[model samples]
Target: MTERIRHDGIVVVGAGLAGLTAALAAAPARVLVLTEAPLNAGCSSAWAQGGMAAALSPDDAPELHAADTVAAGAGLVNAAMARLLAEEGPAAVRALADLGAPFDRTESGAFAQSLEAAHGKARVARVKGDQAGRAIMEAVSVAVLAAPHVQVRTGAKLTGLLQEESGRIRGVLALIDGRPVEITARAVVLATGGVGGLYAITTTPAELKGEGLGLAALAGARIADPEFVQFHPTAIDIARDPAPLATEALRGEGAVLVNADGERFMDRYHPAGELAPRDVVARAIHAEREAGRGAFLDAREAAGKHFPDEFPTVFAACLSGGVDPRKQPIPVTPACHYHMGGIATDADGATSLPGLFAAGECASTGVHGANRLASNSLLEAAVFGARAGRAAATQNDAKGPFTAVTAAELPPVALQALREAMSRDAGVIRDAAGLTRLLDLIDALEAAHGRSAPLVAARLVAACALARRESRGGHFRADFPGRAEPVRTVVTLPALERPGLRFAAE
Candidate 1:
């Protein structure tokens, strides 16, 4: 059976920093915001530890920020978007502060700044060390709930997008309280975060499995650099399934990376050592683990006295693992964290399909290319989220009387196996053999599970990873150890033909 539900104005999915920004920008445009979880619970924005990167300090400039972004991107960023984000980031940060975000400021009332992995200057504006995400989301959520024109619905999970015969996106299909329903809106924006959930050990909430990217691709939107997945180097290696993150900011504060033998090893990988780019650092840690060296973040010697106030979350996580940060190094491992690729969008967050837009970690606006620079994710979300919302609100359309489709059924056990396959094979490490094997398994699972949302997300990730042959940034290949000439690997759904699992010799 099929059911239809109609909504007026712009429809925003995900309710994170980007979604809230979109709602605020679309004010007086009458927005309907939907979230899968209670607004602040599972969204990645609230889990962000490092703060927004902007040219807020007197010694910093947007051009410097842009250059750092380009360097981290490994030569794949759109110069225009990088410039725009850098130039406009300060104003956005200021606006959030005005909305009561309570950003940490210096004694002189200037925004306090810190440096992360690839940034050249102390340009990251934070709040109380690692409380930026919680603080920012708290401020945004208050404004969103108080807004007269925004209606937010909790427990609304997106199943797919609704598109017309002409290939234009009209609205979305959602699972509201377990009942499938269709929503026709004037415009639709996807702020559904990233694909961190696809991994067995990740820093993102378990519900976000590249759903936004799959929806956009199925709707015939261009998908860019779907192979680029950023792995944060130091997730606390505890018994937790989705491991707790040890923020990169700790390294910026001089925490050292040591082996089980208490010897610092990052020095051999890069001269900057603990201060190297995330991809390099992650690989070093992975190599250590592979060699049975056992990696650990020795924060005790440096920030032990400041653990409770400086990094409460990390302190608590270490406590849960039966290790006190005040006395010992925490067991660490590289965990899948952020996705640098997603549904392709322009500077204003418009996709090729009319009435459809994307922002935040789910949209590839060329700000983060092969690898995203640390702390830039939040900046991109606020900057582009506002643009997306304003553009979507101004757009007008009447989706003809909505028609719903019967969803294909699936068997439960088959679905679990598919999730396991994706987590194991397409995870942090990859090579031609594993990817090919994973694609074959995905084909089998799709045949059994049918073309549901989860299957779609899995297939797209596997296919795109298979198609991108070179090793770059987060997409590492043991076989191909260096980056090939950089070009965005753009993909389109339904145009792909799954070749049988076989790899020719290089």
Candidate 2:
């Protein structure tokens, strides 16, 4: 059934940290926020365990943070943007603290920080060791609910963008439960998280399968770096699909990665050993598993007595899976965790299409170039989410109304096939043959499903992976073992329709 819409000052989709932060930033100006699931249930933000990183400690500085970010990004981060976010990261953490996030503190009542892999300092500010995501999301959720100007609509899924005759985004078409509704807003922000749900063995919620990227693409926005998907090395592999994550913070606190033979294996992979960057760790874990060495995180030496308080999430997940963290090594396997590429955005979170901004994992903010640093995802959400909100709130317009088109749904079997194809072909490892087969499979799926929103996103990732021939970050290619000349893969839907599916170099 068709329901007409009401306009708001801003519309923010996906009520994770980014969407809620945007809503809070736009406050006093009426805002509407939508979430596909209950606020705490589906978002990757709540699933995050490692904590937010900021140069808050006495020994650390923003410059150090920027340098680490640049190092992790592999020379692709925008210098100005990285500097701005890193310099301001402490304040962002403070703002969240002011909003009542219960961060762990030192004995002196100062903010406590932990060291994560790839960082040179103890800059990660966590909550109860591993409850950072849950605690922070809960705090923000309370703030959003209490905000007088922010109205949150739960169980509302954004299906597509509504545009003006001039091609500016007007608002969104959403499905609330089974009923379809169109809501017009002066501005729309997409914060629908990452593309991990597209894979078979992922840590992200099954429902969040790059729908925002798909919707944005179908609405004609430019996409960037669609090939790079980060796999976390320590997803507990107890015969579970969409495995549980054992946060890297455990190792940061001194846990070691070992093979079945009780050998410390990370030393052979990188100089950083247990503290290498995530991509390196994930690749190491993948290689170990592929070689039948059997890998696990042995946190017992460090976290035996502190498991419950330090890492409630990991402790409980392990308990449920019949592995006791205090006595046993948690079985681990690499699983898709984050996507470095997404709806392309400028530093201010503005997409190619005006009036639509994206933050969090849904937008490729370029802060995370080839891969994301351990806890930087949450930082990017708050900093850029606020930026996007402030930028969008200042720009308001009155547009004429028009009829809205409805969103299409994919069949059950087709959806399963798409997931299986992504998990098998476009997963952690890539090769020319696999990626090419993935593209062709996507083509066949689209021929049947008419390039439905999800399939469009899947195809974009595969096509981009097929084009980028070199192994870098989360995208490792056996065919192209070395890093070739680094160039960002940028694609526009119109450009893809050209012969050979080639994107013109800018």
Candidate 3:
């Protein structure tokens, strides 16, 4: 039995930074926000500890920011997209301020800046060291509630996308309080976050298992760069299911990466050592743990005395876990943090299918390329989220000949086993045999349980990683540890097949 609910306004899914920003920006037009969690609870935007990146300092500029962004992208970055993010980032930060976001300021009343890896200058705008994400979301949530044009409904889980026969997306099918309902709208924006939850050791919210990316692809949208999953180098390893992050700002402040014996080890892996690119640092930490050396982030000498004042979040996390940063080095490991690829979108957040726009971690706009520059995720969400909002508001697709859609069922599989498989075979490092084994498991799961969203999303990543045969960015291949031609991997549901991979069923 299916129930239809018609909404004449733009429908935005996932009430994170992007969705909230879009709802506020789509002024004069009615907006409906459907979220799986209250406000920012399950959204990655609220989990971000590092501040947004922008060329706000007197010594920095957009070109410098774009240059560093290109360098970190490892050859696949689109120069134009990178330039746009750098150019619009400053104004976006100021706009957040106008919305009452309390950004930290220097003694001179200018926005304070801090340096991160791969950046040439000090230009990350923060708030109370690591409270930037929480502060910004608090301000944005207040604004969303006050906006007369927006209506928010929390705890709505998306199941499918509604698309007309003419390739125009109408709205979505969701489960609200466990009852299936179809909500049709003039336009739909997928701002759902990343696939970090697919791995057992992750820094993202556990429920973000690439639902938006999978649902969009199932509806025939093009997926881009699905293989590139960036692992943050230093997640606090205290046996927590979803690990707490040790922000990269600690490295920027001169913290060292050492082993169980307190010997600094990053220098042997890269010339830049602690300040190396994220992929390099993650790989180094992975290597250390693999060799039975154990790994820790020694922030005692760097931000120890200033712990509470400089990084209250990390301080509190450590204190709760019974580790004192001022006295001892914190145990750390590489954990799945962000996905650099998702449903492919253009500059204005338009997907290949009409009337569907995307922003934030769910959309791959080619700005992050092979690897993301540190602290750029928040900026991308705000700048592009607003753009997608305005574009969706003017959509005339409301006149569409809408189609009847059936909701996809959750696949029955061993969830814990699947996550352990991904972490063992697909985390930090990879090889052909491991990826092939992963695909074989996926093939059997799909064959027996039908195509589930989480399985489809995981298969998209593993299959693409197998096809990409060389090491690049976060998708490292131990068998082919080198770079190839810089072509981005783009695919649809039908195109993501592994004809060459073979494995015996368990």
Candidate 4:
């Protein structure tokens, strides 16, 4: 039997920086926050090592930040949205600091910032080096727990979205303690993170398989740019399931990329060497590894003894793999990091559906068009998260007859197979043959296991990637190695259903 409940306010799915921020920002309006794991456990926000990007220095301005963001996105970034994110980013970081985020501070009481890959200035505000994500999440978790109008229900996994015949999302149907519970509310917000878990090698939590995105699409919402997935160039290759990241800040601090022959190779790929954009660096490392040279991040000269205190997270990970960063080069590989596409949303986080709002990695606000700039993930989550929260709080409760669309679950073995396939075919470098094979595999899996969320998300990535024939940003095709006219991929379930549908530029 399914249990039903009615909430007279907004329901937020996901408990990461975005969802919690939304819950916090929706002041005086009752907000119910649901998550599959305990606060800060399974979400990528807590695992973020590079911290948030914002223009905090006197010489830097939001205009510069926006320009850099647009340049890094590889021609598909929404300029207006990038401008908004940059203009509001400083305030968002400051707000988190006020909530006791404990950002690293300079002696002059200003934010201690660091330089990252594509940014023109040193503006990434970090904490205790690689502890930025954990520290900031700890502070946000504390604040959310203390908020009067926020109710957090952990161990609740979202299975379906409740929508009316008119396509209005009412709430979510989640599984709590192995029982199905339908919680209908005035509005529904999806901030369920990204689809990294779909890949065999990923830096995100294993539980994040894009259920929110699949459910939204199944319930008929517009998805944008589902093909642009950023692969981080330096995930520590220590045979871990969810690979530990060697943050880009290490390169900004003068770390170099070397091969097994101890030859610095990034200079051959790009002029900026280790400071090149993520896609270029990732491809260089991939090529090196493919050539049997085996890429490595030689940070020994950069951090050395300061590694323990400066990047405790990376230090511990290296130690776990029997490698010391102070004396040795860390083995690195490109791993699934961030998704630059998701449920299409406006600046305020409102999706095409009337009552469905999205924020964080799950929402594509045209900020991260193709490849995400280093450290901007956290900033987008904070800035747009608050916007979605406040905007959702303004909606008045609506009553309507709706149907609950529940997704099928993929078994463990099948999911592992799917993951391996994704990493092989649709990963850092993709081509028509690989993508077509991947889609065929998805079809077989869907035929066997029904249309699971992970399968849907994987299909979306593969199909769109196969359709997009040009090499641009994070998406590269060996067969078609040139850029086509810059166009955004706007898709809905109905549009995707049409046979031979090519994504037209919006």
Among all candidates shown, the one with the greatest TM-score? 4
Please, what is the TM-score per model? 0.95, 0.97, 0.97, 0.99
Query: Candidate 3 on 1-506: residue-level lDDT in tens?
Result: 66788888899998889989999999888999999799869988998998999999888999999999999999888899999999999999999999999999978989988889899998899888888999999999999999999999887888888888987899998888788789988899999999987888999898888888888888888999988999999999988878989998999999999999999999999999999999999999999998999999999989978998999999988888899999999999999999999999998889989989999999999999889999999999999999999999998746657764443455435556667778878889999899889988878776766777878789888988888878998889999998888889888877765455432211
Tens digit of per-residue lDDT, candidate 2, span 382-481 = 9999988888787676577544433356677887887878877888788878877877877787777676777778888887787777888888888888
Off by over 4 Å in 4: none
Clashing pairs in 3: none
Candidate 2: where is the Cα deviation over 4 Å? 400-407, 504-506
Clashing pairs in 1: none
Better of 3 and 4 by TM-score: 4
All candidates: CA RMSD (Å): 2.4, 1.5, 2.8, 0.8
Give the Cα error of residue 484 in candidate 1, in Å: 2.0
Model 2 weakest 10-residue run by lDDT = 401-410
Better of 2 and 3 by lDDT: 3
Model 2 CA lDDT for position 283: 86
| Cα lDDT, all candidates | 0.85, 0.86, 0.88, 0.94
For residue 286, model 3's alpha carbon misses the true position, in angstroms, by 0.4
Better of 3 and 4 by lDDT: 4
